[model samples]
Target: MAHRYNLNVFCLPSELVDTLTPRALVGQPPPREPSPPPPTVAPLASAKGCNICLGATFADVDEQRVHFRTDWHRYNVKIRLSGGNAITESAFAQLVGGLEDSLSGSASSDDEISDESDAVNTLLSKINYTSLSDVPEDGTLKAPLTALTWFHSPPSTQIGVYRMLFPLDTPPSAYLSELKAMQATVEGGRKWAMFLVAGGHFAGAIVRVGRISDEQDEVVQTRKRKPPKSKPETEVLEHKTFHRYTTRKKQGGSQSINDNAKGAAISAGAMLRRYGEQALRDDIRNLLRDWAEDIHECERIFIRASVSNRRIFLDYEGCVISKGDGRLRTFPFPTRRPTQAELARCLQELVRAKVSHLTEEALRAQDEAYLASLPKPKPLPAQPALESVEKPKPPRLTKEEEIVREKWNRLLDMVSKGRLEPLKAFWEREGQDLGGIDALIPEWTGDRRASILQVAAQAGHDAVVQWLLFDLHADPTTPVPLAWTKDGGMESDASDAEAPPAGSRRTAYDLARSRAVRDVFRRCAADHPDWWDWFGIAHVPSALSKEKEEERDDKKKQRRKGLREKMREREAREREQERSSEVVFPVEEPPKAKKEPPSGPQKLGGSSGSTDGIAGLTPEMRAKVERERRARAAEARLR
Candidate 1:
């Protein structure tokens, strides 16, 4: 799939490619046709807040003005000046009424004062800490100038945002102005080099603009022009080369030779790739030298190449373009393999900026609409009268059920304590019908609501985990319940009701926390290759059977032993030759598969018509002669 070019996007159609990217704490774009605004709801009117009382909001300016004149406000001011929190209007009234003095004796004054201070402290703390997280006035969120302005979802990630960097400090108008100036350089016919090198295919060209649009736009950059109709000067210089075909992946799919590469072809292809890399580097270097004049006149150099492939143009052997070249810029989105036509497309794409903008309210609306489009979560299932709705406990337990629960609890404890012996004994005593093991099925626990398999795994009990997996037939695919928030939702950006949860949510396999436990799981999974959903657990299970691996190891050992013996024999031969004054002999190679003709056949030099010697030959002799002829014929075909 093509990489998303506009990630903070709501919807960035081709028509809106010029839509101005939003910047935080910056002025809005100049007025355009505004979409229908969200339902009007004026935010609460806030003033500097009463300085003495620390009041936050009021009905209007009139009420705020009246608030300062109130006796309680003045009294609160005095209380603040005395190095303590101000009293509330109600508290001030109670103190002024002298109710404390009437109820108690002279000792009441100190008690009343202490109570007022305590009440004021409690009121001020709430006001001081409380602020709407979504409102810009609170300094948490930046207010959007237009309802359609948007912030990147993952505030830190800015993978495909346009030329403007994330956390952009400049306004859109100024950014567009800069872009306009750059576009003017193109319109004025300055040369720009575009390069796309990937998967052994390299296409690059220094070119001049053909068609230019005067209107600086929201998204649309330029209209497509027919290649034949366009002038030849559009591409001042061009170079393309294709060499490496070592991979099984579609051409230009990737630069790496992974397992998908054919084993038989890999040795030869590796050589080709090594040559291709150097050839590509040499070609680029020569091309740059040849096009020095054109390169010097180049306004900007646009390159689109993978990290490994790009170095030929930038770093290798004193590249023409320095790594820190100001003109250096990468294609901000995915591109097809380097080609003349693709280079043309890249030229058009460079001028366009694609991003959709929306305010927080707009985002909320979209999220709500998206949620509303989904099927609702099913309500909880009905339970017996003995079960509690809030806690969802098990039904009234019979003696057998009570015994089972006790045994289950004991098994849990045994797993936690690494008492696998007792755990196995208990399993046997309880009978081998482990289908009802709570962790194996969807049933977490009767009362504890815990996944016993997860408990075993996280305890670093590989033996226990294996026993549960193999002996008890526990399913590693079964999902464990995750901790939920108070709102009955998971703490994630998106939630899937159809499944338990999504994104980082895992099954029993994940609970294999330690290396030992994880290795145990891997080994068991390898053993029973097709027993579970291995992909869901992110494990590419190896064959549980190790026969192939063992065979390979044995062959390697035998080859090593043979080589060592041969080396020792050679050393002894060399030593004997040094001590003895005898002539040195040539080392003999091992005998080949083909056998030499018998001396009898070579000596019998006769014509085809000389059948007299063969006439008296016995059937066994004739058969032997025929076999020798056949072997020679077969050996000739091999040659």
Candidate 2:
């Protein structure tokens, strides 16, 4: 029979062998052992500090820049010259360039790189780069981070140009080549991971190189830890390695100088341009809301003209977004942008509505003219500036008391008749030397002008509330009480509900009516009073009478007192009964009982028979009885 042998042979690419399988052999060797490859010097260019730091560090051949060296990463990189000389930037770059070119075949010079050119360098100047000793021994990094440095450059600018090196068992190419090969194998690797810098630059390629251990997989898979008695489901992993790689575009992602400027300008312009339509609409809605709020204080007409370029603009729907009540409202526009004809029609409708104030025949004629002119309205011309004239001096008050009066009058006038357009300007133009409302209206504190009140109510401005209530000392009941009125026969706004108890008056009807605040009216009545007049009166139940209300309160107090009294009585009765029924063992007989006891010796019967008669019958009997008694007494004494 012929001799039989089993053998296995395998061959892999140099890059694969460089990382996965060391040059050393395993198992049996061939009869002709291959000579050991020449010893190669580990490149200083490839050496990094500790292999634990997790950061994106690169090494670029063209830039001759290598980040994450043993010194730079672990300690610090200092350029030193021989004989106590200081090295220039050019010299330092030259040395770095020479080292880089020696390790990798690339054209680079010391003069090519500079701190000025590197944005990361600029940022790094502001931070203190932590030394290697500060870094934790384990790979995990703690936060918040103290500082970070990358070629002293910002990634948003001249970033991604430099590359980094980290010390590891395998050569850097082993990692790079493997990633490239995998990409070629899988869909040509079209997509890569990209990094975004604060300055806006993009760069780098990320790679996954290896799998986590089976032990790590178990730990990571568990939802929670097991009990101490039970077997552990997983083991802690010492290291995590990547198994895939990705490349990202390294340059040209940050904004240009001109682009930044243009963006800022556009943002500012939007603030002004967008307000044109909004301002007109807001002015109109404000008027309506104010009118609703101040109907009691004489109703006043409000009108505002919007000058655009110079022509008057119209606003169709200017509903309020925020009310003094802190409510928010939004108007729905057409789902799609409106057509020109639609916009024109809307404008014409507004014009017709306002023109009603004119005479009927005149209105008709005006309407025809307006309709005809609608197709082409004349544009407004810019106002001409008159020659500058000497400004007049403001009035001076001799008395401080008069000063307050003047201020009060001014605030009243502003609220009642001042145009909204000039209101803000007037406030600034006065060169007023007052602080807050004190400067505005020191004395007109009795009541806020209807105009201001209307504005406050419409705008839901609570500061106005303090000014009116506290500063003006406007009594709630002066005109219409601030409290809701729920008298004996009163009905709530919602008549279906019962009236408040005879004296439980606390509603805000007029305020609600003037402000058109519907919700407030309903709520205030429901909790404070029971009746409302908002709905027509139906026979609603009347609230309790004042006496009845008081009785209810008194009853509540009485019930609590009764409970306390009952508890006290129960405790006292228990103590008294225990004392009265307690069993008492007699230590000594009572005097009355002791005196009568000698007569009860006869026949031992109910202590009723005559003991003297029995004693006379026989001495022998007595002797026997005495002997028996002596014997019993002896026995008792012994026991």
Candidate 3:
């Protein structure tokens, strides 16, 4: 739907969807509607009546001015600022103070108006509400960044909403007839509900029939309110899957096709959308259960869900509503993602009394403006007339004819700098139209009319090279004007370089920029050695076939493994030495020398001759014995 805020908002509901729809008006006389004032009544004649008060009109400017000054207008202004529709004057009159106090009350700010607000608050409290879920902390209008809520409906798929109008011209019978057309009746006061579910967003509530009438014409619009402040920051949830990212590992390839990668996005997106669908279903079921009693009170249920998601809300296990329920109906127009605001808009567009201000002239002008705004259709391309008298061949578009200008650059760029799957898929699906896979797939684009295979090989796209040579049986020896000099692997991007000199041709083998790409060409040659004239194409046949290449790769891998092991061993040794040097301990001193006792040892001989452990005395033994004897004597004396 239109992403902008609606401006011609003649009526704004306090809630996205009401708790009740209007009671059907079967056999009831239409409510009296306001008619145009006589031309002589200048004050009222020019006025279309007060928009704030849904069913109110002013007799004159003085009355309108008086109404503007009342507390009711101030109360509605607060409500509108809070993102709610204004209540009717009659509804306001039901307040405890009634219309008397309401009209008598003066405009006040903030806290000063508490008493007046209390009355309106009490009236609101009477309307029981069951919120399906908490309002997102960030406004729901902003799409959530999480994969859980990533299923944004494609652009231009939904109908846009611009304005809402309330008319006094519709009759009671007309409302009843409309209800009848919807297979709903005037049986319950809980008229109809709007249930919407998409992308984990669910909004469902009963909306009652509401009509405009003449009453207090004093319903003045709320003005001068400051708009809500914008948040300084918004949260961005990171993707839970890596499949959606572009590795940019490929050389030249179709990015659009590569980015999608067929089954990858379809499955990933479907998974996310499926989760949201189930979540939405549960939310709808929860709200329906919350309003089970309310649904019994409802006359009809308006649902906006796609075919796949419809059953989730309408016919899931133990669901209150069924797909075939007579009360069930779908929106006539396209709808946006299921949110409370969208649900409210649907009701406003569906059943609210609307007045079209556009006359035939205005409509005509609108049509002309619309036509003027549209992009003009392009003229058909001219085809050459056949001069041959031979029977005209069935008119078939030439396979050699270039693709549409819109897609030409995309294809060129994609092949040059995209993933492999897209290039393979593009050829698989549109190969015939794109002139099928050729060994020398020439792209006569811009100043660089080089072969696509040459671009792929030069860009280090081994996967694309493999697919082309193996699956398409493309000859690696097929040559084209080279973008590089004879340096081969040292060449710069071909797309940026000037065109080669006349007849400077090279095969994809010559342009191979990486070992992986060369390996692919080698494997292709090994598989189909006789497929192309290698000599004419300037391709030097490899001495090693695919098996020999693999053997060489194996030996290189083993050498790399040995080098990595040695490096790791050296690092470990360095770390160990560092740890040992970081620690220190105290050193011990050598023992002091003990002096020999008297060399002539008579006492020592007497003690030594008596066979204690000391037998023959070396000079050292006699000194030790003497010292022990002296120590014992000292110990005996001390004791």
Candidate 4:
């Protein structure tokens, strides 16, 4: 439907419109220009520039902010606040002076103060500082506070003040004087502090210089146990305190002061109270004099200082003296001299800084000089004279005895070589004087105690065996004489000419059975069966007998079998000859003739006197018989 529609404009309420629009747009005064961001202060001309976190420079506000927010900057800040980082004495003094100037300027100026300026003022007011020459004697500030003030100061000022306060090159005596002056200034029960700046660290002590006395015991009413009247029940004793000081930063880190400092301070103070200060000084002078004398006497001296413990160690020659903690530790000289200066240097370095210049050559020279100074050792006591001793001479053998020895050696040689003839000759020549062929050689004992028969068997000499068994008539059955069982269990005496000692032995059969002589035994058994039996072959071990029997049976069977085969071949040949003869000459039957009785004796031959007896025969019959005989011979030749 096409119909005319009326349009109505809707408007926001005046209150809503006002709330929606910002104040600046509504014609209200705009927020004042954001205060123009407070102009950034220009970096100072004398600024050493940040070496940490910010690098060499902070080029803009953003860079400066970034640097300050870094962890490196934060860690350095923490170190400064904790007093772990230190500055020179001069630097600290300068810082204090600068702070004083800043405070004065801020007070005199009419300019409004800012948060940073207020902070600077607060830090300045907290620090308690004075000139080195005009430090207050009764100042209440302690060393920790002083150290903290120094650490919190500007870096440049801290360095300058620290350098001025504790010069590194100051002598020990100067430091001591300064400490004494500081101690004198402390008031009430307050302690005096003095620090030595050495090796870039602060090491010193805090001392309560004035004397203090107190009564340790007071009068008391006893309840049950009472003191004896003689001993005095109520005692009033006054105790005096002297040389009471605590180490502030001896050495460094967590190390405490050694006992040497404590003992020296205590003893010196006590001596001063008891005998006056002059006496104490005199004792110190005397001690220093003695030390000087010792140093001069030493060939080489090592002066060492421990910065951490503020101790000194002296090593000279072979002696080691440790000076620390309130006591001096003196070690006895080492026996083995040091070969090089490195040992002393290492030892010095362990306890303190090394001050001696020593080397291997220098140490060697010093050691030589020290050794030369020592007294010469006494000569060793003369050794007692040894008594002369005479050894009994070996008895010289007689000519006869020498000859017997020679013959005996020769016999052994011949036996070993299996020379039957030579051995027999040697025996024959010495048989009478040697008592008998069976007489044992003195040297042939133990494993060598074999008889002639055994020796021959061992030599594998059949000829020697025969000679010994038959010609020499050696007792084959004789039991070998063992050295242990010889001559009725008595050791054989070589000097006894009548009867010789029997030696350790074995049997001839046992010797022959040895692999070295086995062949000889086998040959003997085969060549002389009768002799082998006579020699008691049956007495051999059953195992050996069975072996021999089996071997003999095998040989016999092989020989018989071979002979039977030869006989069969011969019969075959004979048969072949007969067959050939019959084929060559046929047998003819004689005409039947009247039987005639025998007269005297049958004629043995006919008139045909030829060996074939064909004189009475016809030519044809002779020829036939000759042919048969030739054929038989040809057959026999073929066989």
Question: Which is the leading candidate under TM-score?
Answer: 3
Model 3, stretches more than 4 Å misplaced?
A: 1-190, 198-207, 210-301, 311-394, 397-477, 481-503, 511-537, 545-562, 585-639
The sequence of per-residue lDDT tens digits that candidate 3 reaches over residues 1-639 is 223233212232323112113321122233333333322322345553555555456777877776675657755655554444566655555453422122234444457555544545543333211110112222122111221100111221111221111112444324323332332222322245667754344566665543222121223213324543322111111101111221223342222333456543445645554454445556556667877766766555677765655766665677888767766666766788656567666766654332223333454465455545545433222111111212445545555443554345555677788567777666666667655556234344542424667777777888877777777776555555545454543346766777755435676777776788887776666667687654345374663486797888899999999999999999999999998865222222223454577676544342222344444557676666666667777887999
lDDT (Cα atoms) of all candidates against the true structure: 0.54, 0.31, 0.50, 0.39
3 or 4, which is superior by TM-score? Answer: 3
Q: Any idea what lDDT model 2 has? A: 0.31
Question: What's every prediction's RMSD, in angstroms?
Answer: 22.4, 37.9, 27.2, 51.4
**Model 4: lowest-lDDT 10 consecutive positions:** 151-160
Candidate 4: global Cα-lDDT?
A: 0.39
Candidate 2 lDDT over 1-639, as tens digits, reads 111121000112233223331111112122233223323334357643222222223345422234332222211222111111122334334433423122221232344333243322321222222222222323222222211111111111110000111112434335344332322312111111111111211111112112222454456558557522422211111111111111112532222222444562254434443343345334434443553322222111111111221121122344322212111111112211223333333222221111012233443464455444433322222111111212355666579858756755575555445344444454465525444332222223554222333333333434443343334432222122222232322324544656554324432223322332333333333444533342223111333445655787899999999999999999999999988975432222112332545655544445433344334646766565556556777887999
TM per candidate: 0.31, 0.16, 0.32, 0.22
Q: Candidate 3 at residue 482, lDDT?
A: 49
**lDDT-best of 1 and 2:** 1
> What lDDT does candidate 2 reach at residue 95?
37
Q: Which stretches of candidate 4 lie over 4 Å from their true place?
A: 1-392, 443-447, 483-505, 513-639
lDDT of 3 at 161: 23
